[model samples]
Target: MSLTLSKKASEVKPSSTLAITAKANELKAKGIDVVGFGAGEPDFNTPDNINQAAIKAINEGFTKYTPASGIEELKKAVCKKFKEFNHIEYNTNQVVISNGGKHSLTNIFTAILNPLDEVIIPAPYWLSYPEIVRLSNGVPVFIKGGKEQGYKVSAKQIEEACTDKTKALVLNTPNNPTGMVYLREELEAIAEVVIRKDIYVVADEMYENLIYGDKEHVSIASLNDEIYKRTITCSGVAKSYAMTGWRIGYTGSSVEIAKLMGSVQSHQTSNPNSIAQKATVEALLGNQDTIATMKEEFNKRREYMYDRVCNMPLLHTLEPEGAFYQFIDVSEVLEKEYKGSKIQTTEKLGAILIEDFNVAVIPCADFGFENHIRLSYAISIEKIKKGLDRIEDFLNQLK
Candidate 1:
């Protein structure tokens, strides 16, 4: 007899963005000049102060297994960060540290979801949300957010989508793929819906510090007391501190939910890395100037990329207010052919761009958007210029 994987494992889709990045690397290995904009991680190195803290922890023999939830000191630091910046109060027990932001989210889903429960997700979402919900035996219901809506759904939309089966809502501000940051008023409107519907909210604010211009990130949990009880605010040091390899993420929620998540994590992975937890304490309580420096560079690249997209005749995109991606609308040229081969979908266009133009971008089809593609500005300014030039040249050739 042949062995088979579980039904859930067989149905889950692999990330299309990662696939394109792998192809890009393969071409580069063969000495091709490939300009890649496919990575979701920052290109910068971890700051020296953060690195030094981890080194100190290692040298001091602090590498043993910590508490399942996390070390008390690191949990306390997370509380302080929430209080100071997000204006949200939480005791140490209300926070749970996991291996990464993704792990924190998985723990929440496993704790909250039951069979056939529904989770409302806004479209043009991070590709992982639906799969994670499915893995927890929950159903994901999507509400589409097009360019007209600033890629943000309204409170009315959320209200209409909710039903008795709805158990949670996944809200991502400074959103992945679209880079849309919800304003204070918008968040207030959504909070009302969550309170009325009596559903949990998973607020992913991973790119909160990377916002540009006069824009600010407002955590929905900080808006009021009831919303605080209903929301799990997820963040980490990966994007802001350039510490993706460190693998530390944290969440703040009600004590009840936090305890349940801690319990779920205990059976799954035991604890996050001990050295990384110590480093995160310093990342939160130590010097924050590194964040400002990285934001400055991201802003420069954002402006340059936005201007280039604006000048291109057929390409269109919203000016990204936060995060480091430019989600471009490529429907205008999708119907055209390149050398008698039709490029009718973003996936086909993406593959051709990498194979012929030597440029790689993520197709947004898996992100629930068709005829659109996403490019990251986390790369160098010179590379951004070259990639944009190649994209424009490729569009010009579409017949």
Candidate 2:
């Protein structure tokens, strides 16, 4: 028989967001002035205090491997942060520190999912959610939340999708792509469903610190003791502290599940870099100022991008109350043509923008939305202005 790859590996969809970002980087490497709106990380540098912690660790020769899950000190720091900020209590044994938030999520799926088990995910989700779940041998079930609803799915929608095989529900507040934060009432309603169904809740709070205006971040687990017992909260320093390169992420869960995840990680990647773990300890305890600065900058960029996109002809967008993206409905231009090429979908539309106008945007087809696209305001305001100008010009050029 001919050699073949694993069915799961073969079936995984490539990340559309990364593909566009890679193309933009490739053009930039060739000295092209490509304005990019696809980056998911902050443009700011990692705070000096956190970097100094890593440097000190290296000087002290703290670079060796720690326990597979993570060092106890860092885990304890994470516990303290969770307890204080999230109002969720956690013992050190209930925490697992992984290489990054993405890795932490993969480990979680692997630990909790069995073959053909179902995970309920809302549409316009982060591109990796379904792929990660399917890679772990689980099935992904999606419920659509329309734009008028702020792309937030309801408890009734979640309840209707539940089945005997349902194992978990993936919830991301200040959600990716859409950038909408679920209100306390909205989360309580979802918590009620999770309680009634007795299914696990996988809460990705990676953007917890980047909320704008009066929108507050709430931990669903903090709603009650029963839900806290069943929730696995994943977060990292990547978004909040401009430490994406540090690769430190963690989960707070029940001790039993945390132990299993640690066991799985032991064979997968062994442990996160010891130096980075030490740096993260400083990130948690060292300072509170860097985060405020970054939030202020991000809020300014968010407002600028929001106003520009909203005023563009044929484009409609939701005001992102949190996170750094504007999800735009571009259905008006799908039926138009440019340079004799008919644009029938957001994928084709995105390709043309990158190829011709030197602008890069993430088409939301991979995000489970066919008529929309996502643009991140993580770049400088100058770049944001230039990119929006190019986008408007490109659309106007379309016939």
Candidate 3:
């Protein structure tokens, strides 16, 4: 008899973003001059204050396990951050700290979803939402927010997509891939629908502190009492503090849901890194000036990348309002020929670029868009210019 693996695990797709980044690194190791735009993290080093806190923790012998959920200090800091930043009140017990934003999401779905439940996710999403829901034994129902809608879904569309099995909806503002933000009016409308439908909201606000321009980052949970009760607001120190390697993400939710997530995490992974937790406390409550500095730099790169992409023939992108990605509409380029071969999909285009043009890009098929690609502007201006130049050269060659 042949041995069998878990069918559920076997069906899962590896993250394309990570795959492309890995491929680029592999080529670079071979001394190839690859201009990569596949990174999802800031190129900046972690702040000195945060790093000092971690060193202090180690010096103080604070490496032992605290609690399954988290230490008291970090939880209080998370609650304080929620109150001060998100304008949402949460007690320490109502907050849970996990390994990262992804872990927090996994915990949310595991705690909330039963078998066969449905999670409504906006299309052109982070590419992990559906997989997480499926791994939790839930269904992922997509609602596409087209280019016409600024890559954002309306409350009416969400309501239309709902059914009795609909358990929750994932709302990612200052969203990934497209980098568009939801206004207060839009959140209010969506909150009304969420209240009417009696569904949970998984609010992923990892990029909250990274928002730019006049747009404010409004947490949907902070909108009203009803939505607050239903929301599992998730965030972390990864994007804002340049602490991706620290692996500290947290969530603010109701006491019952928080307890459930904590219980699940107690068995699954015991606790997040103790030193990282100490560092995250500093990240949340320490000097916040680094965030503003980072945001300013990102805004400049965003403008430069947007202008360059807009000028490139057969390619166009919405000026990213927040986050660090520019979602390019490459459908026109896909319809054209590249070196006498039909460039049918963004995947093919990506391969041609990496193999021939020495550039790495993330095709958006895994992001629920077949004719688009996502380019992250989280690197330096020099690298961004170089990569964009290579991309333009490729576009110019399309027949």
Best by lDDT: 3
Cα deviation in Å at residue 114, candidate 2? Answer: 1.4
Model 2, 206-321: lDDT tens digits are 99998999999999989998899889999999999999998999999999999999999999999999999999999999997988999999999999999888888889988998
Per residue, candidate 3 scores C-alpha lDDT tens digits across 242-325 of 999999999999999999999999999989999999999998899988888998999999999999998999997888898999
Candidate 1 per-residue C-alpha lDDT over 259-364 given as tens digits, one digit per residue, 9 for 90 to 100: 9999999999999999999999999999999888999999999999999998997888999999999999999878888989878888889989999999999999
Model 2: lDDT to the true structure: 0.94
- Please identify model 2 stretches exceeding 4 Å from their true place: none
TM-score comparison, 1 vs 2, better candidate = 1
Which lDDT value does model 1 have at 12? 91
lDDT of model 1, residue 259:
94
